[model samples]
Target chain A: MAAIRPGALDPARPLAAVPPGDPGDPGLAESVARCLNDFFTARRGAADPTDPRFDGEVVARLERFTLLGGKRIRPTFAWWGWRAGGGPGSGPGAAAALRAVSALELIQSCALIQDDVMDGSPTRRGQPALHREYAEAHRSGSLRGSPRRYGESVAVLAGDLALAWADDMLDDALDGTDRRARVRAPWRAMRTEMIAGQFLDLHAQAQADVSEPTALRVARLKTAAYSVERPLEFGAALAGAGSGAVAALRSYGSDVGTAYQLRDDLLGVYGDPAATGKPIGDDIREGKPTLLLAIGLRRARERGDPAAADTLRGAVGDPGLTDADVRAVGALLDDLAARSAVEAHMRALLDSGLAHLAGAPFAATARDALTALAGHAVARLR
Target chain B: MAAIRPGALDPARPLAAVPPGDPGDPGLAESVARCLNDFFTARRGAADPTDPRFDGEVVARLERFTLLGGKRIRPTFAWWGWRAGGGPGSGPGAAAALRAVSALELIQSCALIQDDVMDGSPTRRGQPALHREYAEAHRSGSLRGSPRRYGESVAVLAGDLALAWADDMLDDALDGTDRRARVRAPWRAMRTEMIAGQFLDLHAQAQADVSEPTALRVARLKTAAYSVERPLEFGAALAGAGSGAVAALRSYGSDVGTAYQLRDDLLGVYGDPAATGKPIGDDIREGKPTLLLAIGLRRARERGDPAAADTLRGAVGDPGLTDADVRAVGALLDDLAARSAVEAHMRALLDSGLAHLAGAPFAATARDALTALAGHAVARLR
Candidate 1:
């Protein structure tokens, strides 16, 4: 109940002291879902429908959208991070830990919804994006104002609600003073970094600052830090993990997380559309300044292929860009040795990150899970 | 430092036991300003400019917009509420209360910025709206992407940061466990209601649900609850006020807060543009579904003035509305008896609220302060 001392936490015997999660990964995911469901049910019970403070439609949409399908990657990472930091590994203890970590999913939902709105993206995960969904509803209902504006407005509130609700859930999950105090820094840092990263991304797009350094900074803050590094750190903090284990997790998270973004950028540009659920080379049309684009541009300029470099410039960020133009851009990237260069970089990051995991100060199975996750995350770098 | 006993807090004696605030209202405002300044300065020092996480332009704009002029109404209410519940009235005690309560202002900034964006208002308090300011910056710089989109994106992040930073300030301001626990519920509810209120506002515009009940509901949630009731409750809670005092504050807050909205509605339609910093009758052009509008429509209908009703309809929600049209609409509201009806209603609410304060369980001077604030808040009704 008091403030935790770093030396008092048993970071050495983490997962080794307990059995594997009884229901394991799938069961952990189910527990997280159940926790979320119970939380929302309690909220629904407490709120009066006629209060105007909570509109039925808004609540329903938020509930449905958040609970719907997506890989629960962040929550899984957080759970593993806790296990890596000497948390009890099974039974109700495991359930409570899962509940706390599940909060990350809600924050992720907020991030994705806001990101989609900011990008003017119409779809996400093969479905209408949150803003688009609300906009369509407005149109269908024959609402008075501009459907787009109304949709965007409500989506903003919905995204904000997701964030506030996540905080509420985390408050409910943390039972003691030590846990709350320890988690506060990482929790604050995670939200701050994500929001700042969003601004940086927008700034990059506005300024067209496409250096590899700029690209990696965006990847680190927006993707790596927000998605991977912070979640692990937060979970470790919640478990009152020692500095050594925390450092190892951060090291592994930073490298593997950056690799994930590099691989994602590659997929956005050249991976199969059916497999990735996105149109190949769509990033070129949107003119998103990913590392893949940075690598291509660098190689083209370095090799003194002026024609290829010019073509790449013309293709990327062109409003009137066509599928044929994307195909041409893809060919140019392949010819310029740009694609292989990024692939090599991703490989190096994953290798380095996995080596850290091997020497990480955690019990056996959790370390193995993180190593496997790193490989799976960057497996798309074909 | 133990859990507060409500009776031990002495909600009845309130401000009478303490000397006149060593720094009174003006000094309290100054302290709030200083606290905010210190917080932001620390944040600036801690952030590395070289790190992409802190965009200099974004940080600077957030600081400027937050520090710029406003009445600081919410913070004042919170401070007085604390005093009314027997918090120390002056010295370091006053300073601590002000620091914690001033967080409401940052939240206010977030609300105003987001409201301006949602309403697509070009200006706020005689300056460019946050989104418009960012858009202007983009255009002046001849940024690569859509200026409007970039502006909106950055504004969203800025507003979010304000909310998060406010939490950080509040976290620092709380010195003990009991105060933290006391503040959590009201804090959570305040944010929840404000966000919900925003949605209700947007919904009203979208649905064109001009029923008086709908309008009243919007006022209650968006204005009465968010801007008034919750802030008072939050402060009293922080001071460990008994439930009796809490209930009385809520009763007084509800009535006075609704009157405040009524006055605001009146100003929107017919008040001096120079004083209000808004164009006269601008709400009519936008067809904002205020209770004033609802009353006008109902009066026109009840009086069998179909032509007047039709004229009113044609006047409101017109994008190309001219100055002459606003004058004509003003004349129509007068003829329909709608303007006086709203004025009479405002008076009744204020009178009823003042009566509640007279019986409220607080010190006589605290009671006097509430009475004066009520008058000041509704002074524009004329």
Candidate 2:
């Protein structure tokens, strides 16, 4: 991937136009990128003057990894959330708000980097994962310890740095603002909930839990809270929104976030690989206890289809599953009407979330942006 | 390994007596322990009511691990540093100071737990390391996927939680205080420096660089800064000390902290295993590029003793080194006068640190306590 030129990422650039009706703010993306670049430049300068290797190994790579790719969806949502809470769109206050929301990307950076280590993913965003890159460096340098261990250790430290930096950024953004207390609550909650949700996700997989409630809980905590609800609440809180507005945004975020994950669950099985940039059926092969699989399994058992139930149980977690096996499972799910059920469930969630937004006392533009974002979230690849 | 009863730890208990002229404070230990227990209790209460497993797995284990065993050296130093900065020994402010200093233990928790994961150590503080405990649970439960991976992942999450909780504690302790900004700067710097130090350590190990400067740099960054200097600065900062006092305390901490590590290096090879609770000669076996080894190698070469130099190079870091090999290395080091040189260096560092303390304007009791602490640190196992 080509390196991003820091100079080109100007924070003062005009907001990019949203194409026709899709949810976007290219200007927000550029400004967040600029903010991250400036932060990293300062951090690099602050690195131990006695040890130049530190800047090279940790900070530079972190900057490159962060700048390389991400849709900046979290920041976008936060922006709309702030707007809905009556935050201005332009001014020093707006700039600070942008800085605060941009911090979400750093948090995202921490999550993805650490998750790659946990999952042993070799690549991210079409490039070598941070750990893998470090491991390769170790191997080339003839390091003494296990290369893999060194790589993972380095990656963990890198992730820790990112997490710490995210906090620093948020603190800087809230420096002179009276919203520190209000903003901090959700920020703290978001961090803990994300980790907790990750733990639960791991636990569910370990226990082979297929219950609908467990699946929904993981989705709500891991995806909804970290990806949507908390970000919305964080923005609303930063704007000093009243309780009713914060509550409405939170509820709306919860529904939309769950719906978004449900859509992802479907795409994991059936979306075009080229479009999704993920292998179709990989989730099934891993036997992830997604809501789709949970519902399908329940329906199969409830219908007294022993063959289908047995096949589903045997094939879901089989690492050696072939394309034929995935096709069979898909066929079984369709026959049980699990696909239709999940699709219908997803739509209902979206509708309910939109209704909450409709009744909320928010700026008209923010309301429209949020509606578009929610629709775009669930309607992807539809 | 007996579990500490929370009720038995009272923050308001009278200060325990110290051995004549020894740096000690049993009351401080009790207060810190009580503060931690109270924090954990509240955190447990705040765990999702819908997910008790999260509390059981993450928070409870972290609490048990933290409360189990530690000399609480960091907090002790921090307390003295605060006192030296004119902080009262008893009052609501003192209580807040205790709370803030207690945060160092949590940061230590993060470091140690993650260190074990990186080093692949199976035990710590006379108990199974956190990762090992979780790995065993996975093994016994016959969980899907790699038990080792799951355990490490869980440990990583637990460490992340500890890090976040430490920040929360510090923030709480500084709430509504004018010292928030002052305290935050060192707190932020400490966190980053610790992680940077860790990265540099791994880099040194990977490259097998045995230069004196590299070894000293690693010692200063990895141990001195995190274990001593930063904690002292954090306390002094929290007390809003003047630049001269903070600078004096920081300088004192630097010398004493490095001396402490040098002494530790000696103990790693020569101290009584029973007394230190560590295997003697393990450092040589692992070929750790300690200052002792660095000095020994340099002296051997300077003396034109090819045999001594070759043996030193070959025996150090040889995993399969026998007792005889260790004995030979020790004899050679003594022959080269490396041990005497390191001893003299350590004493000089301690004296220099104490002199800095003596010249600084500080409370009488605090100065005395710091002097004792410096002596205790470098004179260990003497």
Candidate 3:
């Protein structure tokens, strides 16, 4: 039941380090997509004949939504983490690593579907949010009940299904791997942290907590551990890596993940809608307590700029905010130096993460690819 | 890695067969409660200090709601299933069986919480629904955003946490057991089936499908499998039971489970709020696609009584139906003999289930205990 095959860890045979393409995975993305396609195809076919509509309504939509679009960033990090931990570049072991890490995307699917219902977002990845789509179908199909409620209810079940299926996928992936127990620890932690992070995000909006500390904590739990650290740690565990390498990967993951979320904060306000696939100024409209907003608000009050502070307070959480209003607020933030301050912070975090990677005892090739990933994570437009 | 200890399966040394007191488990209840208490206590204490609010708002409430009350029906069935499969009466293996079965309660918690939000239920188990509670707090505290939206959002997250924690609890229970993979198959199927069943229920309501077949299908998936069959099968799997015994238990579970749902439908329309802990006629008001309503409608139509059919249809799914309207519908169902028909069907189901038990090679004590459970399941007022 050994996870690694003999000579798999030989220094002379470094793991593959495929370069990412244009802010996303090129080579690994297909493998991940194909893996998911096969899995869902089987699931779809297995839909009970007693309820044919279940397949059309739920299973089909889930398959389409999952295969629709994602950056595949989480799986990429996990794959590289496995490679860095001395897993062979090819063979059943490597294939299992790919399948195991692909489960992260299903987790991502659950988060996004649930988040949309919670936020009442209109769109995701340029398509109507899953709930919104279901709601629209209800309206058009002349279905009974409140269309909005029906949509949200269906979406919740859909998210729950994805979460359950993700666990099943992980179990399938670990079928014969001796590292199942090792991978379970991080996987379990990641799921709880994801839910806890979401709760905090909701609370921050409700209580209007705009503190930088709260913002960072949310980013660390919601994004850092979930998006980077745990995925890397999970992959390393899958390879049975020594504690030293696992710790280093975790350190690097935390820094990079935080930076990545910070970058997302910037994108939420400034990134093009076409690229980010989100409405402009959604964070402001939803009153999300991101680090950038906290800094902006703090700087305004500290500088005794009551007018700027008042403008921010008035615009945030205002669902009726117009695009023109958003542009004006963006200008105000820039004038207050909040945008530049966050950018500087993001750079510092990324630099620190790379430094961790530099000192880690990872295979030579994984180190190079990891550097490229850190760069793309922070610098990407979307 | 053997699941059973040597000599643990001796027929002469039968497992404990504690009689259920009143409507629920009296003997096993305390053990399940203590196991949950210790687990949640550890979880609450482990809450990160950075977000104290999360602990109070999310984790603590989850702990309270889980520990507050439940009939512990699923766990009781699982325990009996284990005994029927020849698991030891008491020891570490027995304790693990209890711990593993208790996870069903958490899953129930998740199902109940999310269901309230979906159904817009104001109360549950004689208290405000979790979402309603959160909504009241938002209004009283004057929190940001729509109180309704906030409440639903929070409830969704709470349910997600419960589901995730339930899995972790099961994992902990299986840590030293050799039956992890065997237990996993049923566990995985049950999770998907639960969600899928829920979706079908929603769909039936939305589509206005009032057929008897659809009603039975929904009951089979939602209640039969999730509440009874899976618990029995899951427990049997934990004991490493052979296929013949497992099949018999499943047959017994399905019959009893469907009878249980039929009883629930009757109670929803006719039972006292004092005992049922739900408002009278709530199901008709909410337009739930229950077997009783479907049968009543079918019988009315088949008897060439359009007036009766119209009255039944008009009364059902009417949100503003008065208490008198419900009473009229109940009288109409009785006059059509629909009530007697359902009662007969339930008796037949219970008899069939008991017959399965008689045919199976289960221990004598377990057989008697399971028969009592079946009677309680279908005959109780609640």
Evaluate every candidate with DockQ and list the scores. Answer: 0.51, 0.61, 0.57
Q: Write the per-residue lDDT of candidate 3 for residues B203-269, one digit (tens) a residue.
A: 8888887789989999999999888998999999999998999999999999999998998888777
Error of 3 at B78 (Å): 1.2
> lDDT tens digits, residues A165-233, model 1?
787788778754447778887887777787888888888777777778889998988878877888888
lDDT of 3 by residue, A172-248 (tens): 88886677788887888778778888988988899888789989989998999888998899889989999999999
Q: Identify the leading candidate in terms of lDDT.
A: 3
Between candidates 2 and 3, the one scoring higher on DockQ is 2
- Chain B TM-score in each of the candidates: 0.91, 0.90, 0.92
Candidate 2 on A1-382: residue-level lDDT in tens? 1222333232222122221122333476777788888888887888746358878888889889887647676777777778889888878888899889988888788788888898777777657899999999999988887889899999999888888888888988889777788887788888888789888888887888867898899988888888899999999988888999999999999998998788878877766656565556766766667888898889989999888888888876677887777877887888888888888888888888988987799977788777766766555433
User: DockQ of candidate 3?
Assistant: 0.57
Question: In candidate 3, which residue pairs clash?
Answer: none
Worst 10 residues of 2 chain B by lDDT: B11-20
Q: What's the interface RMS deviation of candidate 1?
A: 2.1
Instruction: Name the regions of candidate 2 deviating beyond 4 angstroms.
Output: A1-26, A48-50, A303-307, A320-328, B1-26, B303-311, B314-332
Local accuracy of candidate 1 as per-residue lDDT tens digits, B36-80: 888888776644442534647666677778777466667777877
Candidate 3 displacement at residue B110 in angstroms: 0.9
